[model samples]
Target chain A: MFKDLDPLLHSQLRLAVMSLLIGLESAEFTFIKEKTNSTAGNLSVQLDKLSDAGYISVEKSFKGKKPLTTCRVTKKGLRAFEDYVTVLKQYINK
Target chain B: MESENQILSTEQSLEIITRMIRQAHGSAKRNSVYLIVWGVAIILANLGMFILIWVEYPRPYLVWLIAIPAWFATFYLSYKHRQEARVSSHLNRINSFLWYSYGVIIFTIVVFGFKINYQLNPIILLVSAVPAFVSGTIIKFRPLIFGGVLFWLFGIICFLIGGPWQYLVGAVAVATGHLVPGLLLRNKNDEQHVQGS
Candidate 1:
């Protein structure tokens, strides 16, 4: 049976973030933005959506007086990603 | 780099995954400085000790004071690297911790070994291998893995080579482990930057 694609992750920016975060233990907000080439306003919205869904966690703090925001993919997010990829493969391989 | 509204094809999603992973791997290594600095310092200390010993010079071991300058350079370059960086990866952090912590371990072994009246050449090499191998595995870099193995092999050989001559083995291991890899990584990064530009 074909598993359904994760609706939350099917979005382009969200998927991009998930792909990058999977390779890393954690990444900063700016790092994600730079890699994704997404504008601050839009990326923030997507991040909120993902964060609210329990797919990722956003931590805010200061880095030497400058505010630092870091993001990490959660365990649930990892499972969702893997399942999404597996479902994606079924489509791609056919 | 695409519109959010459009449905991505399966091939496109796969491509994104592959591309992003490659990009993550392509991020600036920042390890060239550590390798080059420590490599040069170790080589100088080893060869200087060898020469001093051969000439029957007093306080030949003081040549290791070169590390004082290396310590300074490490701090300066690290600050510079941090200033210039836009993003720092988890891999980069781990690599930094591995080498810097390994540095303290090596320094302690050398200084304390002197006080204890112990031969540290073999011991130092054995210790050096830990960081080299672990860092290599972390980055999936083969040269450093080979360098770690070289340290282990040379460490054993130091016992056979005997006395001041073990300094030669130490030098060779440093050259292989740090110097060679530093130069290669520098060149690789340079080439990558050029291609990127």
Candidate 2:
């Protein structure tokens, strides 16, 4: 029997973001947007959803005068990503 | 590139994960500036000290004061780099902590070990080898690994061959072990940039 995929990570952009953050200590908003090739608005919304779910932590700070938004994956997010990958492999192998 | 809520097929999901992880891995490019700066500084300081000693100057050790400016420059550059960097990796964090610890230990040694007489070269070189070896291993940079090994070899030689001549040995040690590897790393970084562009 195959396990169900995590709904939060099943989406394209969110999965991309999680995968990016999984190996990083942290990443800035612009970096995430650039790597994911998503619009700022869409990325922000998705990031907010991930933050709300406690899968990631977003910090807002200032670099000189410019505001910087940084995001990092949480332990929960890592677990979810690992589970998603395991289930994804299960589905693929079948 | 669809809607944020669009669920991907299993293959697409796997592809996205694999691609993003690859991107993340590539994002953390090694900046050769730290190695280059510190290498040049050490070389210059050793050379300066050797010259001062040869001239029979009363304040031969004062030549090390040149390191103060080098330290300031390193700190400034590091701060600037941190500000400009978009992403931070676990490898970078670990490397930073390792170097920071090295800095603290070196500072303590310089300040307190002054009570001893001309026994610093071997100990300093020995201590320096750890960061170079560990960093090279972590980054998979062979030149740096070899450089670290040279530092160890030179440290032993410095211990066996004593007196004012030790300054010259220090300079040679740094030239081969630190400066040369640093220059090679800079060249590597330049080539990477050209290829990337």
Candidate 3:
């Protein structure tokens, strides 16, 4: 059922981010940046796309005097990820 | 009004992604506060017990039993909070580590204070390794795995050292092992808060 949905999440960068986030309750911008090896500009764009699709959420705050950004995956996102994985399995099985 | 088929601008996409991540986990401020409070209380209780032992107090063993109820309290509070806020598995894993640490510390003090003759080497190793192992497995944290290895080494050392020094070594082992990791976790939590805003 979800096999067809897997490709929606298979993008190299987006998949990396999603995979990392799936394992975290929340992750700091720096952590994600380091993990994905993506620039702030690029990562920000990808994050926005995911958020628009209801896959993740981003919060911006000031830590001391510095700007801090953190991200967490929503329940909707989790469901989508699960569905996506299920879809991917069908393709693999075939 | 030019064309409806145009894709979102890069900036717009980024904004949407950020929002999605934000919505992934609900507000954890309350849970964070609860955990901080719990950590402080546990530290205080341990300190109190330590002082009591230093004073040659009686029935210091009873202090250990306080953990049983404390565990229940923590469970209840966490359960209640879980209903109010969506806590990630990562946060819960860290919380579990904290509680397990507290339990082990209290248990160690109680056993040692009462002059109980139980062989503590294996028990201590198991207690310390379990949380580290779980953390590593669930969170894929190398630091925790390394900490677990250190604990195992300490356990072996305790067995080899034997005699009175075993107590001192055990104290040092735990202080360095669990306490250090707890402190590191607290620091990480602080960093997250800084990042989370």
Per candidate, chain B TM-score? 0.89, 0.86, 0.51
Q: Which digits, one per residue and each the tens of the lDDT, describe model 1 over residues B1-197?
A: 66567697778788878776665554334676689999999999999999999999999989989989998998999888776555556767777788779978977887689675768998899899889888877766678889999999999998677878999889999999888977776776543431110
What do the candidate models score in CA lDDT, each in turn?
A: 0.81, 0.82, 0.58
Work out the TM-score per prediction. 0.85, 0.90, 0.46
Report the CAPRI category for model 2: high
| Candidate 1, A6-91: lDDT as tens digits | 87888788889889888777778887888888898888989999999998999998878898888888999899999999999898
TM-score of 1: 0.85
The candidates' DockQ values read: 0.48, 0.84, 0.09
Q: What is the DockQ of candidate 2?
A: 0.84
lDDT of 2 at A75: 95
Residues B44-100, candidate 3: write the lDDT tens digits: 454555566677788643554555665677778877764443234565657566656
Q: Which candidate number has the best DockQ? A: 2
How should the candidates be ordered by DockQ, best one leading? 2, 1, 3
Give model 1's clash tally.
0
Question: Candidates' interface RMSDs, in order?
Answer: 2.0, 1.0, 11.3
Off by over 4 Å in 1: A64-67, B26-28, B79-90, B114-116, B190-197
TM-score winner between candidates 1 and 2: 2
